[model samples]
Target: MGRPVVHFEITGRDGQALRSFYTRLFDWQIDADNPMGYGMVAREGNTTEDGVGIGGGIAGMPEGEGGGYVTFYVSVPDVEATLTQVESLGGSRALGPEKISDDLVIGQFRDPEGNLIGVIQAMSQSA
Candidate 1:
């Protein structure tokens, strides 16, 4: 099966401004108490019970970074193996193979063309 684009993030110099803009433009519900100045966005009137929507976040840009960009996360079967493949294909790791939870691991990389992308591995029940 092909990897699926599962999530996205937008980073900006001003987290609150970005959040306000998006909330006004898209009517998204944003969580305000996130510790890292990140806001989680929920689509307005979304009815999916399985969390199937293309949910995303808005956050302050990395310190000293010149600008911000949007990043999409692709779901993969194995983060380490996929990162190896990414390297062999001339891509480079940008962030992690960090474990986010018991079931989820995520990583970010820069493609050959210098675009940032993310990969996620959600462990199966039997894993």
Candidate 2:
């Protein structure tokens, strides 16, 4: 794992609209609905910095939920291991350390005060 968040999912409504707005506003070339509605937000393949990664996505909500809020994913070597550390460090798990792809793993968790955070690692380094 590279201890980086190369991809991010922008959870919200009107995926196309949000994609369009960002594309025009920031001139971001977003490939929305690329696969299974997992739209990609990036600038070419240059989504990495040094060794860190940066990426985002867009998805729908259940009519009434937390939308339009961008979540921050911190770099970590292993989501499962990191979650264990988080729990031991006075944090709690809010979501799974699920594998979104062979190269990506995401797990939502919260701090002692209920502030959400995430952990991600690349597949290449995962081996």
Most accurate candidate by TM-score: 1
Write one digit per residue (lDDT tens) for candidate 1, span 6-117: 7789988888899999889977887868567679875545436875577777888878986788999998888988888899999999877998889889899999999999
In terms of lDDT, model 2 sits at 0.71
What's the TM-score of every candidate structure?
A: 0.83, 0.72
Off by over 4 Å in 2: 1-5, 45-53, 62-65
Model 2 Cα shift for residue 19 (angstroms): 1.5
lDDT of each: 0.83, 0.71
Provide the lDDT at 12 for model 1: 80
Q: Residue 63 in candidate 2 has what lDDT?
A: 64
Q: For model 1, what is the alpha-carbon lDDT of residue 74?
A: 93
lDDT of 2 by residue, 69-90 (tens): 5677877777898898889999
Give the worst 10-residue stretch by lDDT in candidate 1: 42-51
